[model samples]
Target: MKKNNSPFGIGGNKSTVSRREFLSKSFKATMATGIAMSGFPTILPASVFGKNAPSNRINIAAIGAGRISRGHDMPGVWQYDYAQLMAVCDLDSLRAEDGKKLINDYYTKRDGKPFDGVKAYTDYRELLQSKDIDAVLISTPDHTHAIIGVAAARAGKHIYMQKPASLTIKEGRIISDVVQKSGVKFQIGSQQRSSEQFRYAAELVRNGRIGELKTVYVGLPGDPSGGKKEEMPIPKNLNYDMWLAGTPEVYYTEERVHPQVGYGRPGWLRCEQFGAGMITGWGAHHIDSAHWGMGMERSGPVEVWCDKVDFATGGLWDVHGIFTTAAVYANGVKMIVSNEFQNGIKFEGTGGWIFVSRGDYQATSSDPTKPGPQAKKLDASNPKILQSVIGIKEFHFEISKEHHGNWLEAIRDNKSPIAPVEEAHRACSACLVHHIAMKLKRKLYWDPKKEEFKNDDEANKMLSRPQRNGYQVK
Candidate 1:
């Protein structure tokens, strides 16, 4: 975290009325009412009054300055006119400085002025204490997610929490409760819900276009393993102690974390102390899609089964390398999750089957697995599936083609976004439970309504991990 110095960013000293929306609405009304500016023309050039600019922007602070912040979340927030990157907080000092520089550069180019008001902080608590910020984007590691989210909610800031809501089931439930109590618009980063491919596939199931959905297969990549435990001196400009805050204290290693100033993948994601591996990371995406397709966004599996799998030993990173989990819902719906299959959710219904991923969508009249992997890749069997018309009384959806758009709209309307906090908890719970099952290799029955196991003491105990020393979420 960088030392705080001279807090307020661009719009700190003034409170001005927002005229952007007012002008847009007035523009439309003027056209409708045959009104004109000064009676010269029906509409004037928008540039004459800076109509393209945002009148009011919500001040925002980013909680993490890692790869996601630099690569995805920051860029996504920048695309929206309703948001302003006012501050950045990261344990990595160099990343924090870089984040602030990026914000300054972006706004300077847009506003035609040298803007250097963006603040930088090493401690998130200090950032949360600011009254200027209206919201926060949390892209921290899994263990730190719940704590920051809970604190941000208590501080009365809207939040955009990334996938895998928390480190444990208990943490997720607490985050859900806190977010609801705060009445803040919480949007989970399960952006697939806003994508056309996933939306169409889910609607097909929800509307019974795919009659009586039977089996859903979610394919996620394997977790990393086998990093050395060689202790090394902490890298300069990196706060190793703060990075390990809320996790067990350990000797610092390059492979245990990431280079403070590097642009490659971080190592904390593969360590159990900081993350639950792809089971929760990628699982949050596909499983949320499955839940959406099955109309179980507020519910989870009734049973989860996994075979015994060995975790990587003799290394600092001990997360699972290879494993598979099968979850069964109450309505006889089965979902097979593994890394062996193609990376996506394959929806097999009685009528037909469809598969959806980030950049891939396919449909088939026969079994998707029938013609084998090669033929399945070559033959686009059910080309007509994309043209299937959704009639009245069929599954309808909230129209939000872009994820960030829905979040901003929800903030304005105080309405629930497509990926609300409770829905996120349910989605993340599946991943947590799957990881637990893979560890125990048990036939566990889940009571989704109660969010617990059915009289299974051992399984229930696994719902929450004991927080190390001073790491508890307040």
Candidate 2:
């Protein structure tokens, strides 16, 4: 693939590169690097590099280099030698340039050669078409994940996308299908699955340490009331059209587009057209953990009741003023996912209960009223309750390392990621059901296997939305 300097280099704006140029340049560069690295007593023939060369380091590009990209994704990818940051894309030129500087500085500080040829793009499509990029990290707003992810898959790039994978049910399905068809590896940004404490907690629940699970309570911040706000001019540096891709075209407002102030209250959350409120944002994480722990990654609730009054309200609220929602699984198990409560996952079983959050994990089974076994001391070496309880210290350590390392290994081996596209779609589907039920102000029955509403036509209408002309998912 001949790499086109245009659409990516100095004078490039937003434009697509020819596929033929992309593939030929990438192949030539890869073969040259392989031959140079494989020097021996006698030079191997060029044919040896074909279909037999070991996979080289993957070149990664990041789309939507926002706050989370800087805080988590960039550092995570940098930690692995098998991946290299090649390009960064953002609607705001300033943020995109800042990310490029950050990556270059990291390499320079490490006593390695600085990234002299790293590219920057104001448009993600241009980055997607670059044959140099093997994968993309999507840390954009919740609504844009599906469109960019699908496009990246079609362009033959693997993806590491942030959570609440899609803003709508249909979008999630479309992303899953695209990845499957393209044979691209995908890892959703639900990092808790890669955490030691979380894995132990999930293992304990899956093994019935807490007895048969009766119910799970996953709490997140509440929903939005779509409150009124004043409109402001779009910043000069921002390309508002690209930012609103796949979303309805509405008048630009500072609160909706950029963070003139702090990130306190983003305007996009209050609008039904561009955001999924808290249900798809924060709920995606907490509820995803609940489903993971319950061993329901492939399935979700069969019905959702939206009249539940568990949500935050009033002018005091930061993003959306007020909202509430609840979901019921087919086996009579209920999951309450709302911003109304503090962020965490609580499981109540017949034997006892366990609670876990980002901060800590606690299990209460010792009865003070009656004589019982003495409480064991905390194991500092393992520090995971499930391992400590079962005396399986070795398993604990291995699981901890494997979870985080799994994504990198998957990328190198071209295998499905730990939390792959299908699983993410299922988690997002559960939240989408709750969002739809709440919007229609009614209880809705769902057919999980079919991925549709059982009988409600009005509720099913919210499954997918009409896309703006050029931005529609194919």
Candidate 3:
């Protein structure tokens, strides 16, 4: 079958194959044969659904059961025939139970029988000790990512973690180093790498279709300035202390954590104590894509600074408001990240420009950030540029159709996923440095190789925050 033309260099020529189609065929072939192409894991009887052998399926445990987990992460893995969600853990008892029901209900309805094999726990430590779990899905807040990821790696289970890989640069490096040494398959939730438009945009630039890559523009939304500061009674179902992690202990407030009633967007996302606002929230996605296209996935900028930054005062939320951060790479490539541009990424070079955005693609509809124009998913200075074919001899990226599926495949094949630990750490480190520069309100020289600020003691101190008594990344 002839493929339709994709404006992002996916399909225009008859000889080209869409990455999605290629991956789909590969999956189908693997399922039909029930054989590991890498020749590991003894083949057993087929799965109950006949997708793959039961022994070949990966048993997954979800570590966070709140908004992102309930909405995106769990759904991404549960439906896959080669993956089974065996357990769920959360600091909140209510959320843990909710996750249990969510998984059991799906399996029960599909299997035409009661399925209650999914277990729920309030403590992640207990869940991690389970021998039945082969992997873990961590959709927790930004603050606890490194610690949980480190523990999960030591547990000898594969990891699929949500990005901004860590809350601090030091934490990111620590977790990445541990994961690499543990030799476990790790995939960060930088889903854009798996998207066709984003990958094609990177390909076009890397292949010199855009001439010399000069500057990349990444647009991310900022959280509004409103969160109640008044102390509220802690909910009985929540283990507030555990949720605090290494952050300073403070009175429980709805705005300081997640909603007690439903799985809406959590307020912690807007708090600086928990995250660096959208700079790391949506910035992780767009900036990581920016790095992929700029060929800086393993390396980062030589310098970073913010031209303007606004912080919300007199509220529980203190993350950056309207902001613009700039970075300069060793190769002289410049990157501008701000809330002003339409929500997406734009690559400009001497030859022309290419712009790629999610175009109404939100992980959850609850996300306030909306694409300015739906028609601009992919565009270039010349329409012919999008039609250019990337030859086999030229640089071609590893294709990934679905983020979670790629992780599972990596675990099976013992190979690196689309977004590996080192790349995720590097991309996140860029955002962290940008955040620090915004806070310092000055241009800071960075030593990417040493992963530290160059000859600046004041700025170097912010690389890692002090973790409270029990929550340190061990």
Candidate 4:
């Protein structure tokens, strides 16, 4: 891990009112004092009065300065004037520096001067120790998400984390519990929740536009079956041990981690040890949408099984390929997850069917698959369903066109965001259960309330894994 000489970056000074407490108490004192003395100025200092006051802005730190952080998370938060980019952290020193430069350059261009306040760190713990940071955007690999999330919650920092909330079911529960106890606002990066087409489809199902909501067809891309197995020297700037986190120690290779040259899609996305392939990678997004439509966002399937699975063998990349997993929720909604569908979610019910997708929108061009030529961004069996407007008395979900903005607003108001921590855990747990069922090649019963496999010790044992190298959750 990269060493830190000081918790506060460069010449930065710590504030007495930490960012964590600022949200809950900052405005209260000012309002209370103003009410008590009608003619007197508020308790807030003069510097905090302006619209762009530093005290009013949230100090956000980027935990993983990789592709998602640069391309999605940082850009999503920094563009808002209420949020400030304070620090960047990554296991790779090169990526950390790159992230710092990215944030600093943006401010320099905006202000028309050399602005260089963003700090770069190779260790996230040191960044968390600083009182200057109020919140964090975690875009780390799947293996490290739970550990970092648990740590960030304990440090009293609000979190906006990437999808596939945890590498294991047990880790998901642990992080969700910690975040609930911390009372810090948390949001999972399931951006589809903020999209119009997805929300409309989900609202349609919730309001009975699709009668009964019988089934959901979720399509996800699959990773290739091969990767170079030859071990390579660890790059000088990358900290391989820290990068591995709680996962098992393995030889360093460019194919095993990320490209040292650029921020292309990383190999770890296809590796089972790091992530459960596209099952959780893309499944997290589509499955979450399915749950939202079914009104089962906080619940999960009662059973899961997959008879058709192809686990890649004899290669560094061993995640599943071209598989189909069927999950039945307690509400009798059967969700079919497969790569054969057109890379989206389709809701089938008694009255009609509705489909929603990004429609040629790929977060990254390096993603393995795209929507077929016939795929549509939003569609329904009947034209009237697509044009129906939701009434105020009818079932309505939260409206958010901006995912990051919703998270920041929730932090400021101490309210739930569009995707809360518990819902994120449920979505990830469903994907993980599907993965386990695929591995065991059997039908497994699940108890959504208890969050475990029913009378299946062999399957339950796979819920959690051993942590090593000083990286462990709880």
* Maximum-TM-score candidate: 4
- Our model 1 lands, by Cα RMSD against the true structure, at 9.5
Q: Write the per-residue lDDT of candidate 3 for residues 58-125, one digit (tens) a residue.
A: 88999999889988999999878778999999999999998999999999998899999999999989
Model 2 — which ten-residue stretch has the worst lDDT? 362-371
Task: Tell me which residue pairs clash in candidate 3.
Answer: none
C-alpha lDDT values of all predictions: 0.78, 0.69, 0.87, 0.88
Off by over 4 Å in 4: 1-48, 371-374
- Higher-TM-score candidate of 1 and 3: 3
Error of 3 at 35 (Å): 23
Ranking by lDDT: 4, 3, 1, 2
On lDDT, the stronger of 1 and 3 is 3
Top lDDT hit: 4
Tens digits of per-residue lDDT for model 4 on 1-474? 011133221121233434545743666576677768787654566656554577678899999988888888899998898789989999899999999999999999988999999999999999999988889999999999999999999999999999999999999999999999998889999999889899889888988998898889999876888889998999999989999999999999898999988899899998989999998999999999999898888889999999699989998899998899898998898999999778899999999999999887666557566534746899999999999998767766777778999898787655567888999999999999999999999999999999999999999999999899589888
Q: Model 3, stretches more than 4 Å misplaced?
A: 1-51
The residue-level lDDT of candidate 4 at 219 comes to 92
Candidate 1 steric clashes: 1
On residues 230-300, what C-alpha lDDT tens digit does candidate 1 reach at each position?
A: 88999777888878877788899988887655656667778988878888888998899988888788889
Please say which candidate is ahead in TM-score: 1 or 2.
1
Q: What's the TM-score of every candidate structure? A: 0.84, 0.78, 0.90, 0.91
Per-residue error for 440 in candidate 4, Å, reads: 0.8
Candidates 1 and 4 compared: the better one by TM-score is 4
* Candidate number with the higher TM-score (2 or 3): 3
| TM-score for predicted model 4 compared with the true structure | 0.91
